[model samples]
Target: MIRFVVKRLWNGALTLAALVTLTFFVMRLAPGGPFSKNRKLSPEVIANIEATYHLDEPLWMQFGRFVWGLLRLDLGPSTRFRDYSVGDIIASGLPYSLTIGFWAVIVATTVGIALGVAGALRRNGFTDYAAGTIGVIGIAIPIFVIGPVMQAVFALKLSWVPVGGWNDGWRSLILPVIVLSLPNIAYISRLTRTSMIETMRENYVRTARAKGIGEWRTIWRHTLKGTLLPVIAYLGPATAAIITGSILIETIFALPGIGRHFVDAALNRDYPLVMGITLLYGGLLILFNIATDLVRAWLDPRLRHDG
Candidate 1:
């Protein structure tokens, strides 16, 4: 188990390093400078600005400086947002994203698992059909479409929640969380239903049944862990993504989250901001994936050996 965990950590470190290197170069080599959109400035002015930010330095030197700053946990200044460090921008937005993401995961996992178990148990019944329909709707409809339609009905028509803003408190979170969780819920339910059905057919499950274990005990003790394996695995990346922020959901709901900053950073060529967020996202993904692997190994000893 120690070897397994160490290996996973080592791999995550390597993945994060490569991510940083690639993102650094790609952003640098991309077509425009952060100042490209600024009001036309004199050549000397641009050169001075570039010098101040070290853009006037060679690419290799810039990369070295970035790495050095990164090692010291400094994200540096944001070019676009005057007086703001990349870290500051991210820090300000993380809480909102975390809150929405946390609740969404809870709602999605709890509801999805229940729906999936019901569907699997009832196979051809109404519960099964309803779950299937939800899965289809969640998967088939894009979030952009869903967000607007929901806002129209819930905010515009019903007036149950504000149209789009963070000032309304908890009521503001409802739409964004629901929208963000919908796809995940759909996916988890489908994965759980399939896994449950397959696990039930395994010989061990039949043996348990032949041994006359109660249905509830058989499901809770013998079946649930196996069914949850895939769901848990999927949750790693899903949780990281939603928690970090859903770009579309954040944009539609006008929520103050880091998700929009990612898009804006890329478009504005805010190198430090872009790199910071990318590293943040990449790091989260790696951490979550490692956590998922560890959890899987703990749940099923076979996975430890496999690792």
Candidate 2:
């Protein structure tokens, strides 16, 4: 177990290193160097500004400084928000993102799994058809489309909920979270339906039936237990996707989250904030994946014993 965990941690470290390097070069490659304005600038002024930020130094030297900062957990200053460091921006913004992402995951996973189980159990019936239709619509509609229509209907037309803001007492989050979760709900539901259906046909399920076990008990004990593995595996990637997808969702809703920060950083070419946000998100994904893998291995005894 120690060896396995160590291996996962090593891989995660390598992935982080590659991501940082790639993000640095890619951002640098983009035109305008973070301070290029449409307005004309005097030569001495430009030199002074460049010198102030050490952009005067060679790229290799800058890269070295970046690596040193990484080792010290110091995300550099933001280009757009001159007074704030990248770390400070993240510190303030992460909570908002977490709040939305947490609610989104809960709603998505719970509904998806339940509807999927019901659809599988009632295969070829109305329940299955309804579930499948809902899933299709969720998958087809982008969050951008869903967000506006929902805001128009619920907030504009009905005035039932605020269009956006953290002050709406959880009600404000209803639309955004639903829109954010729609795709994930659809995908997980489909996965769960298929997995449960397949598990229901296994020899153990047949054995349980032959033993005269109650229907609910047989399903809860056998089918669900087996189907859990795939669901667990999907969750890791789903979480990463959900958080990244929020980059658009938060921007549309005008929520103060890391996703929105990422958008702002991109437009302004705020390299530190952009790269910091990228690394933070990447680290979360790696950590989630590793956790999911460990849980899967724990749940499936064969995994740990296998070469």
Candidate 3:
């Protein structure tokens, strides 16, 4: 297990490095400078600005400096937001993203699993059909559409929650979280139902039943562990997606999260800010996937032995 973890960590570092390098060069090659403005500036003023930000240097040299700063955890300055560094901006926004994502994951996972288990246990009954219909609807609707509709119904028309903004307490979080989680819940429920149904027919499950174990006990003890493997694997990437915040959802709801900053940075050609957020997101993806593998190995001893 220790060796496995070390290997995954090394691979994750390489993946992050590759992602950073690609994003850095791509952003530089794109049209327009970070300092581009509608108003024209003097050649002397432009030269000074470029020199101050090291944009006047060779591309390779700039990349080297950026990498060096990364080694010391410095993400450099924001070109558009004069008062804040890239790190400062991320620090301010990350907590809100994390909070919403965490709660959404919790709700999605719990409800999805329960619905899946119910559907699987009942097979072709009404409960199974209902669960399937709900999953289909959830998957069919995109977050952009869902977000506005939910805001209109729950916040605007009903006036139960605020229309938008992240200032309020739990009410502020509900719409965005629900919109973000709906797709995940649908996917997880389908995956879990399929895995559970297949696992129920496995030799081990049949043997447990033959031993006269109660249906619920057999399911809880023997079936659930193996059934969750696929769900666990999917969750690694899903966690990163949620935690990063949804660009459309954040924009619609007026939430001040990393996703909002990312959109603004890209549109404004804020290379430092864009690259910083990209790297942060890449790191989270790698780390979450590694954690997922470790957890899977722990749950199923066969995985550890194979590794």
Candidate 4:
């Protein structure tokens, strides 16, 4: 177990390093400087500003300095928001992103699993068809489309929630969370329903039924544990998608989160902020994948022995 964990950590570090290197070079290659929008600065003033941020340095030197700063956990200064460091800006927005992502995951997993189990248990019935139809619709529509339609119905027409903006507490969070969770819920439900249906046909399930075990008990004890493996595996990538995809969702809802900061950083050519947020997101993806592997191992003894 210790060896497995160490291996995963080592791989994660290498992945993050490659991500940083690639993002640093890509941001530099893109046209436009962070100061490009400044109104008519004298050449000397522009040079001074560039010097202050080491932007005037050779590309290799700038990369080295940035890497050195990262070694000490420094994210450098934000080009657009000159008053704050990249780390500080990210810190400020982290809570909102995390809150929305967490709730969205919870809702998706809970509701999706229930729908799937119901559909699997009542195959070919109304519940089965309803769940299947809902899953198809959720998967077909993109979040950008869903967000506006939801906002129109719930916020514009019904006036149950604010149209957009993060200042209204739980009511404000509702629309975005639902929008984010929709696709994930659809995916989880489809996966679960298929897995459960297959598991119910296995010999152990038949054996349990032959022994006169209750239907619910047989499913809960003998079926669901194995049925969930695929869902658990999908969750790692699902989590990364939910977090990163929040960029568009945040924009639509006018939420103050790192997703919004990331978009602004990219558009303004703010190298430090852009690279810093990219690294943060890459690290999160690695961490979530590692967690998924660990949880799978814990849930299945075969995985433990194989590892």
Best by TM-score: 1
- Tens-digit lDDT track of model 2 for 1-307: 8888889989998998899899988888888877896367898988997887778999889899888998899988987889999999898877877878888999999999998999999998898899899899899988888889989999999999888878887897888888888888898899999999999999999999888989999998878868878998999877875665477787778888877776778888888888898898889899899888888888888888552
Model 4 over residues 179-292: C-alpha lDDT tens digits? Answer: 889888899999999999999999999999998979888999999878998899998878876765478789889887888776788899999999888988898899999999
In model 2, residue pairs whose N, Cα or C atoms come closer than 3 Å (at least 3 residues apart or on different chains), thus clashing, are none
Q: Any runs in candidate 1 off by more than 4 Å, and if so which?
A: none
User: How many clashes in each candidate?
Assistant: 0, 0, 0, 0
Summarize candidate 1's per-residue lDDT along 131-197 as a digit string, tens digits. 9999999999999999999999999999999888899989998999899999988999999999999
lDDT score of residue 87 within candidate 4: 89
What TM-score, over all chains together, does every model reach? 0.96, 0.93, 0.95, 0.91
* Candidate 1 minimal-lDDT segment of 10 residues: 298-307
What is the clash tally of candidate 2?
Answer: 0
Best by lDDT: 1
lDDT of 4: 0.90
The lDDT of each candidate is 0.93, 0.86, 0.90, 0.90
lDDT score, residue 253, model 1? Answer: 93
